[model samples]
Target: MAMALETLSSPIILFFALGLLAALARSEMTVPEAFAKGLAIYLMMAIGLKGGVEMAANPLTGEVIRAFGAGIVLSFALPLVAFAALRLTSGIDRVDAAASAAHYGSISIVTFVAATEVVQATGLMPGGHLVAVAAVMETPAIITALLLARQANAAGGPVAGSERGELLREVMLNASVVVLVGALIVGWIIGPEGFEPTKPFFVAPFQGVLCLFLLDMGLSAGRGLRQGWRQLDVGAITFGLYMPLISAAVAAALCWVLALAPGDSALLITLAASASYIAVPAAMRLALPKAKPAIYLTLSLGVTFPFNLTFGIPLYTAMGQWVGS
Candidate 1:
């Protein structure tokens, strides 16, 4: 209860609330698209570097390997479960179900970032290798989704104007993956001493920048919900709300089996709980061109994202604490 109150009361969440309220109220305020994109890049780089540095300090261990394996397994497996649930419970067709399932299988970096803050506030330091786990988890869900769609006879040929390696390139070389992996490598090489000079820029200003970025995110989410909520039926909306908990439960069970620390377990649970609005959406546009971006994007960005931000983090953190203890 105290943790929930603290999370809700934090400046970051409050700022997010402000943006959400402002947008829903139809306030004319806006964050410029280019600037917001820049903020996104900076946030990714910051988190990646921090994670890398932490990895540098810690020795390579079997536990880290297990965590990475767990992430990959979850990424590959969750979409199958999600696809089944969506097909059974919702009216979405196979292609759309697969696309949406891909999202649930992928990690949301922003949500991971937010969870890091909350986890650290609880004084549990998450493992640095989890950043690598996150990067590894991004693409397998897309493969599983494509496979699911193909098995359902929903597979289509290459999208027009798409090169042979295009989807692969998008999956492997997207900005988020590139910057995140590159920064992680750089941080691992530099370690703490070499990273000191840049602390003022990357470390000190992080929370404030995150506040600004999340405010913009809140606005994006609100505007998306306002515009797209009509497309979603009650079951679809209900799926968006419940699916994260389902995924979190799966992750928590895995965490227990793996015996991860509370902080790392919470992060893994949150990652599993988060849906992708960035990487998977782009991949879906290309891979499942027939899939309705409106449904997937709206649910991921509007419903699941906000739910994870506002309540899900605290819940996952508490769960991690319980399982770890």
Candidate 2:
């Protein structure tokens, strides 16, 4: 595990905690919602483009395929575990649990991005296609969660304002996935030499840009916690903290079984462990409207996201090293 102080000391995580604390303390620190949303788009695009450029530099290999395979399978499998756990432990009904489970199963690009930052901090080398792993992992859990809900007969009425295919559109075209995947394919087609032309804009300011993005993230987290935390019970709140850890453990074991390199294994574990805030919540709102956003989104965005950003990524990476190395 990463030393508590070490993780706490990270500028990114500290900024996150500051936001959480500020929100709880009722400090009116606010990011203009539109601006924050723009930052998010910028971050995703930058990361996606960078990953694609790197991928262009390195030819695809069996390891890349294996990592991607692991991502897909993990994305599909995590909701099953979360579904069983949520149903067993919480007061939530099937639809809520299934919707929530799908979130656990899906990837959080921010969390993955945060983990990439931590990996670089730790001097670890992960593949560019781990970004692709992230893209592949986004939707499987949505499918699984829907299946679980259907199997349990938990499709709770036409979820609020959500027409039939609305859920499909949300799941398939969430901004992060579309931009990330689209950019990756673009980069792949363009290749490394072709990437240099865009390097000035995409690569040059990534870190400073990331810090700006994180400051907005901090404010958004604080605001979210202030607005939504009342909906979480002790069980749900605890679930938020622990579920990512549990998912990470499962992903780590899978990576070990596949004998993946420590770096890629860590990325996979991080992706599995991170819960979706952007994509899943919107879809859940559409697909399972009765399920309280306060419980799941706050748990994900407010609770789990902060935890992973601050502590979980480093710890998961350390564990992946122990297992995969």
Candidate 3:
């Protein structure tokens, strides 16, 4: 428990807390929306470049392919479990449950990045291909959730005033997914030697940029919790806190089966456990409009995200070590 508190009180989480408090207090402090968006893109590009450089140093083996494949499958499969859990445990209806579950199953690249930093701080080395795993894990849960929504609302008419293909477009080309994957591919094509040319801009500014991004995230989460938290009852609120641990435990078990190294195991488990704010939330806005974005967004972004960034990363990393060993 002391360890958990130490992890939670880390500078990154504290910075995030500062933003959350500022937003909740209705401080006029703000990061320009356009600037925030650009920062997000820059962060993605930096992570992708780093991953590609690492992959260049290592050969792409069968294990790498297997890991990516497993990530895709888990991303596809976990939504079913999450959907059932939401239906059984929360007041959320079918459409909302399905939409919310998709977010839980999808990867949060920021959370993964944060986890990577934590593991590195602990002197553990995660595989660079984990970035590829994150890329592969982005879209499958969105697809599964859409399929679930289609089945649940089959008898009912289509969502009113919703355009055709909006959900599909959002799922396929959400800002986070497009940037992360595109940058990953760019990095792969350029390789480490190629990435060196842009290192000063992409590499050096990363930490400060992340701090700024987290500040915005904290503000968004605070405002969200302030507005939408009442929608969550006790059961629902508890789910936000506990589901990541559950997901991580399951993913850790999978890591053991796959014989993943400690570092890579932890990274994959963290990705599985971290719920998407970027891709899934935007998709929910279009796909499940009747569903309250505030509720799920706040729950995932406001509640669970902070939890994962703070204590959940360390817990999962420790668990991954125990299991992988």
Top lDDT model: 1
- For 66-150, candidate 3 gives per-residue lDDT tens digits of 6787798789988898888877888888877887888888988889988888878777898889998998788889889878988
- The Cα error of candidate 3 at residue 111, in Å, is 0.6
TM-score of 1: 0.98
RMSD of every prediction: 1.0, 2.0, 1.9
Comparing 2 and 3 by lDDT, which wins?
A: 3
Off by over 4 Å in 2: 1-4, 157-164
**Global lDDT of each candidate:** 0.92, 0.82, 0.84
Q: Give the TM-score of candidate 2.
A: 0.93
Sort by lDDT, best first.
Answer: 1, 3, 2
What's the residue-level lDDT of 305 in candidate 2? 84
- CA lDDT of 141 in candidate 1? 96
User: After superposition, which runs of candidate 1 have C-alpha atoms over 4 Å from their true positions?
Assistant: none
Using all chains and alpha carbons, the TM-scores for the candidates as numbered come to 0.98, 0.93, 0.94
Best-to-worst ranking by TM-score: 1, 3, 2
| Candidate 3 structure, TM-score to reference | 0.94
Q: Ten residues in a row with the worst lDDT in model 3? A: 152-161
Supply the global lDDT for candidate 3. Answer: 0.84
Pairs clashing within candidate 3:
none
